[model samples]
Target chain A: MADEAEIFSQLKQAVMEGDEDVAVAAAQAAVAAGVDPQRAIIEGLAAGMAEMGRLYEREECYVPELLVSSEALYAGLGVLRPLVIASGKAEKKGVAVIGVVQGDIHDIGKNLVKMMLEVNGIEVHDLGRDVDMERFITATQETQADLLCLSALMTTTMIAIKDYMPAFKTQLPGVKIMVGGAPLNQQLADEWGADGYGENAVEAARVAVRLLETK
Target chain B: MHRDHSVKGKWVKCDQMTSQERWEALVNRRPTDRVPCLQFMLGHTAVVNGRPIAKIYDDGAESLACQRNAMALYGHDGLIMHGWANAGGAEFGGEIEFPYRKYTGAPLMKKNPVQSEEDAWDLRVPDDILSVGTMPIALEFSRLQYEAGLTVTLQVGSPLTWAGSVYGEERLMIWMLKKPELVHHVLRVITDFIRRKADYWIDRFGAERLMAFDLGIETNKLYSPKQFETFGFPYLREIHDHLTERGTAIILSHICGEQNKNLPLWARLSYGKRGMVSVGKEVAISKAREMFPDCVIMGNVDPVTVQEGTPEQVRMLCRACIEEGKDHPGGFALMTGCEVPPQAPPVNVDQMVKACRELGRY
Candidate 1:
């Protein structure tokens, strides 16, 4: 079995290379080698992603690099995802169902948010665009997830968060919902009846974890 | 930027004119005397300059200031703001996580928020466009701008864009293939809402004060011209006609795309009849002029030219836009096909405007 140090390095290498296949293979190997899946995910992939994000923010990397690296992270998750489940290891500290709100199609930002969370070892169920009220509720029920994260990019569509919460509790009272997006924030989140708000991708995961810890 | 912009020449007061009167002059290929240059007056740009993004949307006064700033900056003969960036389809009713990015400190609605067709059906246009959320606050801000005697421009929903907001771009694209009826339904809702909201603002600001597009195409076409005509045009025409009836002479139809399949149809629409096609570079504005001689056109200069190119390059480009457009004062408006990149060096923008003013024989 390899030490956490070795596996982390390999996982970082795969992600930096933007090789999704290699990232996934390495992540699987990491888990198989007795490195904790969650640690490998959070520390290994997420760290590399953070660097990528920083580079992106700095203009060192553009869209293609960010996208390719995200894909690599996706591949890493794919490999490690099943093991956490098969072993009933509870790999995800908590699950989050996230999506862009209705009346909005913009997703690059949402995808980034999702990937960032996933790399942090949150079980992210992406409810792709224009998700209905029921599906949002149903996904929560199905996953018995810790958090429901909603994203609305459009000023027009963001208002739907108003309806979602009422429906969410009326349907399932215990589920916690966090809504975030470009046009929204902690204040708007509270106004919209969301339990909490995350200002950005990194914050979303941190918030998601905190939400679950309380749960 | 040269520390002082002494706009020493002539500054006209457009306040006395009613919305309808202003609309008529600009829409019918009449010379409004000045181009409409509404740069980042409100919405995202407002958020950029004003208080934090969260507060700008929340505060009525701040939103107004943003709008006024945009108007002041460009002081175009017209103003255009057809819509705003949302968190995504999911927040409204789709699936997305539109975070207020801390790094860039901007907001966005990502694409592919909707996960399925059923989700699309389950959605409706929320009334909050005017009443709830920051939108109503924005409308109130526009009202304040009008009350304060500012020339007005606003945005409305384009069917395709509205559909994209609800269904997610990917799903909407698939809907174009699988369930176009659903796509049309979504479009109808957004179009109707936009029209209704336009009417609301028209009641306040009066219809047709300033010209702006519905921003029919964002980065370019994901739809063919035929599809746009078949699906998008009818709605656009209806809105334009409705606005026209209410005294809106020009409903600028905006597009920034590679394929112009829908452009000719967009050109023919009554609102866009003498109206400007805010075309970005990939499409030939000159060819568009030949195809639709009466239609006004704006933009095609690459941001590179403005951001990095010399004043000479900007001058040359603006000259081309004017020369190719052949209708600057009357039938043409000069502008970036998309919003001027916010970070664009102000000098290039100044150059573009200067060239626009100088190139005209009028």
Candidate 2:
């Protein structure tokens, strides 16, 4: 049987190459070898995703690569996450509620951010695309989420973020708000009373972690 | 570029050319009085006219009227057209929702036409392209432009962007890696559909009078240059070659978002008699000028700044863009990097024209 380090390297390579079968096999080997599932996730699966995030930032890889790597990461996670829970070592960094705002169905950016957040060990409640303001408020309250990340790709739909801001402040007083998308900038996020803003998904996860640390 | 003339015993750059005259001069490669401000706006026009945003997408006559009124109000030069970036889904058999409700901007694709591999294989260009969804509205809008002697506009896809609408963007993107052949098949169908649509438009309105444009969102932020070369460039080249060969006089490509990496590829496409390229803020106007030195460089102004920023800020950005782009040999027009946000302050929108008038004079 391969050693733990070799198995971990295999898992990371599988994710980087977007090979789900290899990732699954490596994860099962890690499981059979009595390697901690959580360690395998953190050192193998999440590490691979984090590398993809870096590659994405450097433009060495693009969204398609990130999407594929995400599938591999999830495939590995599908094997290991339940084991981690059964081992009673599933500690989340924080909870996050994420969605594309109402009137905008474009969720690619939101989805990316969600995956990044999940890789960072945040329990993300993805509300999907064209999410209503009420849904966001309810999700945040119910999840008692540490952070709320909103995305809007269109100029028109971005208005929903601004319109929903005051209500979020009133209803979910302590929950930190984050906004991102192609149309948004740091200035708009500041103006809209968001606690933080990310230019891309990797940066978004970084900001979410920072915000959660403060909380 | 406008020069100072003796007005009331003072050297002042007064109104030197009408909008029509300025547009003509720019297109024909003649000297213009000053920097022309072209708007890449859509839903904002309806908002300014106190109409639902849906009017701008669903009702072509109303879209034209709203746009014209907004143009007159702002005193900007051109680019009055119908259609959004995500345009082909409805034409290809997907359901679309026009922006009638609050917070809705442009039309939204309620469902994609292709959901699975089988659907992808079955996708084809409609036999009657004109009778399909939103084609009638687009035709009516073009008819109005033709009647008014304005530039008739048509949204021809970059094929890849339309494919994003035909199949869902994420699914299409994944297919680009896992099932590239399938992706190419869909792109092929989209290109054929775009060609048929372009032919119809050219047949109806003389190619010389139409501005064939593609709103491309294949930003480097989304796709690698290689991905674009494979999926985007070939289809774009085919369409552009076809348009130029068929005597189409102009093509305005809104190379939307951060597509600096794709510039080399974009510069490779044939742009007919004249080309106009509009870029988002992530791309510098100077870079756009360098890439397409013979094509008109339209923008780099941040639309968010135009929406959320102060009038002074908008003017400053406009001034910066005009200064950078105003001297391109091909031509230049001050415009928002992307679609002007629907609820941008009126004064902020006016700031662009005001900047052109005050600082952009030659």
Candidate 3:
């Protein structure tokens, strides 16, 4: 007997609290009540994730909390995505190809970025870690992505960013390239000809959206 | 390849102080001719020695040669004998893959041993796990460094870090929330393994001769202060107490990434008083010195600058680090924030030593 706004608020609370069962229940309730799937996602799940991002930025929550909240968000999405697709309301904001550069197997940062981007309605094609340069180009060309994001944890692995920037510029002329990781700074990103630099997952998502807008 | 040890550049061999004497003076907060400069340059050493990364990591002779060659090249006061940090997990039944190139950095954990929380129960510290995998390489390298009269610090990964490698970071993170008891159980197993290994090393090298019980996890970046207090602090305290009871003089801890928020928690531990904490590039050395007024502080220099920047830039930064901590009541040593990259310019390292000699004098 809950109203539509009540159901949406429940979904949002479930996500913020990282309760997967409650999130799925709320999503189902929204669907059963004839509430719009897009509204359920944007106003409920995505809104909760945006709040989580703010909490992360303020250091109120850390990686564990962010990760669990993301899991809960995905649980809600699992139920709502099909519904949204069926209703023709599941429009991806932008397409992005992401990976950690070659010689680097540290993918946790990249994984976080991917989740953040997906939660923000960007379609992400993850290439995993230790990805070769050619594989990045292939993924970008195949997906016709709007942006390419690369991550590297070590200075040695980060050299790949500088080495391959020109090649990516020529090969995927239309795609914007963004690089990030512990060892990288904005200066290094600019020096490597990267179009953008994201200090963390939240910023990476924002950068992806901005890149698509500019494109 | 033997080079004469003479007064070169600004670095003069102080005949009055042996390497141990220099280090002891610095640790005891006594004045010395110069502050000791320890180089964590194993990756750079392997590349300069022309050894394959895998061979250098797995073969004792190759690792020793690389360490010795690096000391001769950089003229550092001490050598770090860390063949690879992932070797502990490999010895604990995790599958690891090392790239074939000369400077590919650390080996990868191809397959973790613990697939689920239940699998953690199956993991047991083998009776001779230390001698089985690349650990023997580290032991032999340490033995060689000890015999050569060089100060040697054997680097070991902390329990949570070893467990993460064995169970994967994502799964470990999930377990920390969902199955914390399992995470604690796995940590207990890893702690036992580490204690046994440390005991063996202490028995062989003698506690005083072993420079310090150096533990690295880069835990700060991964866990919040609360989570670290729950999962990381207990094991760290256990290891610290175990080693201290065995007459280990100093315990050095390295935590990578921004650790400004976790410094107070680290300072509160009992063994933290007699130890040195190496913070990453994001931490300001001056602030760390101000915060931990009673502890010896060791680093905050950007490793990337040493790897890619000019020698002059490296020298300037090294000098600035020395200037920041020159007058702290707790002692300071000049070192890279993290491990030096394999491709870090030798000239930059030379400049680091030169800067320490010039600006680090008490």
Candidate 4:
């Protein structure tokens, strides 16, 4: 009998490889074999992605690697999300809304944050890219998400976050906002008056989840 | 002299205002009545504007006429002269895909072409400026920009990124770590190639009409800042040095990524102290004012905003840009963070230039 750790590893590998078929089977197999789905996702798939993040931060990988990891994690979630939601066993970490900001189409980073969230057991409502401030505000309200994440690849679009957050707080007071991307930083984040900022997708996920705890 | 807002002004005529006089005023932190212009137009944007990629790559009178027709019809300032945006990497054999632009009918992107270290080795820097497929087309276009008496800058990839396109990003990082000499060797060749190309354009356009060099890629901070001291900074310095020897006046270094951490090490690109540094939007020009307080700072328009936004939004951006960035004599130029998006609405761009004109001088 394969231990939970062993089955989890297989699931992690499947997710990282972007093999949705293998990921589903591996995840389903783990559950049927008496393994905890939450542990499998967090310690198994999420851990693998977390390691990939560490590697990426250290420059062990590049954009393609980051992209592949995101794709893989999502592939695994395509299976795990349903099983956990159906059994009422899905994570109660917190609900979060995330997407890339308007005028920018790059979403690899956005997708990676989603994977990290799902693996950490947070229910996520993704609005996709080219989203304006209104969409962010509306999504936060409709989903009643505890956290909102915005990503921008260009500095010009990144400033739009400054505009969005103020408007968001006007209606949804104290709703924390986090922003990240190639052209943004902690200073710009501060200047823009964001609640938080991250340099990469993994850091974004970690900070977002951390914010959720305080909320 | 106060000039009215008219696109009909002889901007390209002999009696027209001297570029140095106008450009100097904008960069010197002096508020001009008319907005001085600077941009980073990617080949992708031109293609995406509904012009066919084939025509953009076609080095012929008809193709040039087509591209000119597209840009001129849009009332753009004029295309910058240079090599294909992907010329360096594609010629060196990087994996790339062409995203079809809805408006321009041109293929818009190419990426991830190189997959390994051997792939990097296989990259051969061209001996001639027009060595790549669309390179001649690029040259012709650049010549046309000069012919129209517009400011034309030739944008090229940085050594590391040009290498990344050939060796794959993974190998690029590893090579920097493990085979420093080998990678630097390849970088030198590419640098030499770029220098040769820059000289070729200068020979054709005359240094006065020539704008600057665009090395838009992640450098040391994105990797190791020391690598910048070794590879990115020095290699770039080589280009600037070469241009300086020829008495060229402008050099814009564009690196877009999580690269703010490495700004202090880029002393060679210092502004006001010696020369000008056009930091991309990735590095906040506002923050850079404090960081490299003496350096000339240009840039940070969002390509996507210009591409997909309403004209009003673009005008708002233009205003915010001038307001946010610090200025001095020769300290700033209005440009995008990286390459301008090909699909950017023509009218939005018009609004941006209009916004600049409203703020700048004669």
Candidate 5:
């Protein structure tokens, strides 16, 4: 049997290669070897995702590569999440409610941000795309979410973010609002009163972590 | 209202060139008063007209009015009668949502028709797919715009983009990796349908008068240059060959995101000598002009800046773009990297026109 370090490395390699079966097999083997779930996740899966994120930022990898890697990571997570919870070793950084804002069905960016957040150990409630403003408020209230991440690919749908800011502030005053997408910039985020702006998925996860730390 | 032209610091009556003449002059690299300004401003036009986006998409008359009013307001050289998003996919049984009030949001696919590899076999290109859905409305709008003496550009997605719409993008991504042959099958079907649709339009509207804006070639952002070369270029070549053979003077190619790696392949297009390519914000116009010296480079202005910035800022950006490509031997057109936002300030658009007339002078 391989040692914990070797098993962990194999898991990481699986994720980086975007091979779901290998990731799951390596994860299950690590669990059977009595390797800590948190260690397996952070040192193995999350580490691989971090590398993938770097590749994406450097343009070495594109959206399809990221998508496949995330899918692999989730497959491993599927086999390990309940185990981690049962072991009582799961440490969630924060609870996040993320969605592509009202009238926008473009969710690729939002989906990427969610995957990054999840890999970073944030429990994310994905509201999917074209989400209504009221659903965002309700999800925040129900989940007591620490972060509300809104995404819009189109400039027209982005208006929904601005329209809902006052309402989000009034209703969910403590919730931090994060905005991101192709058309978004830091200046626009400031204009829309977003608590934070993420230019891309990796940056979005970093911003989420920062928002949680400050909270 | 004839705008004054400042040629070498002298105010002169700008030659009243029809939109078509201006486009032709730029394409032919002839001496012109100034660089032409063409915008992908369909959603912005809907906002200017204060019309529901759904109504404009579904009703030809409303779309015509919106396009006409936008030209009247912005004094642009051309107009695009953009139809519902994913109209072809919708015609093939992809469920679509047509929401009102969202000018930028058109009829988007609510459900993809091709769920699995086997589903590709079930898909068929209806004979009247072009006339079905909101396409007829768009065609009618184009006809009206043409009749009104305006240069009408028709925007349609590439086969790969249409395939992604027909089969969900995620599924298509997976297929690209796990089932490439399946992706090829779907792409071939979509290419056939798109080719027929282009032929239909070209036959109805003289190819010289109608410019087919083939979009979605930027799959390079999602796939590698090789993947695009394999799946994207063939269909694009087919359409290009078919259209050019029928005398389509200008075929506008727009790839939404960074396409730096695919620039070489794009330069190899059959009509590269006379066609136009619109690059995204990630590509510099100077670089595109340097690379595709034969093709007319259309744009690189940041649409986000136009949407949120002041008129002065927009003018500054427009001036910068003009300065970058004003001397390119193939010629350049001032345009947004992507569609101008519906809520972009009219003052900013006015400033773009002003910048083109001022700094774009030869």
Candidate 6:
């Protein structure tokens, strides 16, 4: 029988290699070994995903690798997350509402940012793709989210973000707004009154954490 | 020397050659008095013409008229064509929604044709290729281009991109690593469809009059060079070779994003009698010039700047691009790195042409 440290290492390795079966088995082993589910997740599954994110930033890997590794991360989370919740030990740092702005169906970037936020311990409410401004405002208000992240891929759809910003600021006070995508830049985000902008998911997560800490 | 003329109360250099003559000279590798501005424009054309953006994609006659009108309005010299980047979804039996709404730019794939492994295996080229989605409109647009004495255009695929439209991009990408054979199977079908579509266009319009193009998004931001070599390069090479063999006059490939790493593999593909490659701002014009010395380098201007930037800023960038790209061994055309944004200020769009007139002269 593997020790908890060895089991955690196995979980990490499984996710990095994108092997769902190994990830699940290692996670189950952690549960059986009486390791704290939160530690197993943070030290094992999230650790692997963090490394993958770093690799992605360095261009050592690409979207395909990230997609598969995310599958493994989710597979491990499936086993451990429920346990953490049942134990009431899951410590999420902040609440976030994330979505692709209306008329944009390209959600891979949005999805990635959501995953990164989740791994970093944010309770993320994903509104999915082609999300209209009203829905985003409603979700942010309902969740009382600390962060609001919007993504748009096309130049046309990006207009929705700019159009919605004044409303977001007027309606949702104290909520830090972050925007990212292929067509958006820091200058646009700043001009639109967003608190933060990320070029990619890893940076989005980092900025989200910093925003939450500041809050 | 090109003569300077007063137009709209400003001293702008006047073209010694007419647009038609200048375009012909550029294509035949003849010297021109100044740089030509070829627009990679689509949705914006409709905006300028006071029509719904969807008209640019859905109605062929309206699309051509809108484009030609925008060309005249902006004084851009070339690239009068049809089709968008995410093109194959409609032709592959997927449901697509044209951009009728305010924020929609191009057609959106409402559903992907391949939802499962079974669908991937079963995917095939349609028996009636010309009757597929967008084909009739595309043919109509080409017929108009022919009648107007313009270069007839056809949309060929960098098969992997078409496969992404057929299968969802995320699914196709995941399958590349996990189910490579499945990705290859889909690519094979798409490649076959593209070849068949090319043959039909050649048979109808005559290859000499046609400019076949593929909008490739195999950027390093999304794909590694190895992945492009495996999935993007082979199909592109196969298609380019076939088109060249069939005497297609020019092939314009919009290497759509940060594809600096993919340039070597791109360079390996054949371009008919001429090749025109358009790169996004992520790639430097000098690098594009280095990679494809014999092909016309079309761009590196940032589209966001054109839409949101001040006119002088736009002109500054255009002047810089012209200085870098104008002396290429093949040829150079000042253009936006991608589609000029649908809502780009007209003044900003004009700045490109204005820059060519002011500083792009030989």
The residue-by-residue lDDT of candidate 4 on A1-215, one tens digit each, is 67887888887776555455777677778778877677777777777777777776787665555555566676666666667678886657788889888655556567777877776667889998778878888999999888888888653466567667778778777677888886577877787777888877768878888888888
lDDT for B140 (candidate 3): 79
Candidate 3, residue A164: the lDDT equals: 83
Give the per-residue lDDT digits (tens) of candidate 2, residues A70-127: 8999999999999988888898999999999998899999999999999999999999
Task: Please name the candidate that would achieve the greatest DockQ relative to the true structure.
Answer: 6
**Candidate 3 per-residue C-alpha lDDT over A155-204 given as tens digits, one digit per residue, 9 for 90 to 100:** 87898898889889999998999999988989999888999999888998
By TM-score, is 2 or 6 better?
6
Point out the worst 10-residue segment of candidate 3 chain A by lDDT: A58-67
Ranking, lDDT, top scorer first: 6, 2, 5, 3, 4, 1
List, residue by residue over B233-336, the lDDT tens digit for candidate 4.
Answer: 77776777777676555555655645775676565453211354566555776766666555556666766567656887777777777776635434555666
**Candidate 5: residue B139 Cα off by (Å):** 3.5
Candidate 6: tens digits of C-alpha lDDT, residues A45-159: 9999999999999999998899899999999999999999999878999999999988889988998899999999999999998899999999999999999999999999999
Q: Over all chains combined, what TM-score does candidate 5 have?
A: 0.93
lDDT of 3 by residue, B1-362 (tens): 11224444533543345555776787666776666677667667877887666656667677778877777677676645664554456777778777564225878788888986568877788888566556777777778777876555665556777777888888888778878988898889888888887788789888776655444554545678888788877887788778878877567777666777776766665542266777777789978887778767777678999988998889888888888876778777888888888788788888877777666766
Residues B1-362, candidate 1: write the lDDT tens digits: 11223334744233333333434565655555444332322344454464544434455676566544554464333352424443224324443332233222223344344556675565566765565333555576676666776545556656666566666554565456547788787777677767777777778776545443576653322344556666677887888877767776456666655545556666666663346666766778776676556666666775535644577777787777767765543366666655554435656766665554445434
After superposing candidate 5, which stretches have Cα over 4 Å from the reference? B1-20, B27-29, B84-87, B102-104, B142-156, B217-221
In model 4, what lDDT does residue B295 have?
A: 50
Report the Cα interface RMSD of each model, rounded to 1 decimal: 12.1, 0.9, 2.0, 7.7, 2.3, 0.6
Error of 3 at B121 (Å): 2.8
Write model 5 residue lDDT over B208-304, tens digit each, in one string: 7777777764545567787778767787788777777878767778866777888877777666236788888888898899787877778878888
lDDT of 2 by residue, B92-199 (tens): 889999888778888889999999999999998888988898999999999999999999998998789999999999999899999999999999999999999999
- Clashing residue pairs found in predicted model 5: none
Question: Best TM-score goes to which candidate?
Answer: 6
Model 3: docking quality category:
medium
Q: Once all C-alphas are superposed, what RMSD does model 1 give against the true structure? A: 14.1
The residue pairs found clashing in candidate 2 are B1-B33, B2-B33
True-vs-predicted CA distance for residue B301, candidate 4, Å: 3.5
List per-model TM-scores for chain B: 0.76, 0.96, 0.88, 0.73, 0.90, 0.97
Please give the DockQ score of every candidate, comma-separated: 0.03, 0.83, 0.55, 0.07, 0.55, 0.86
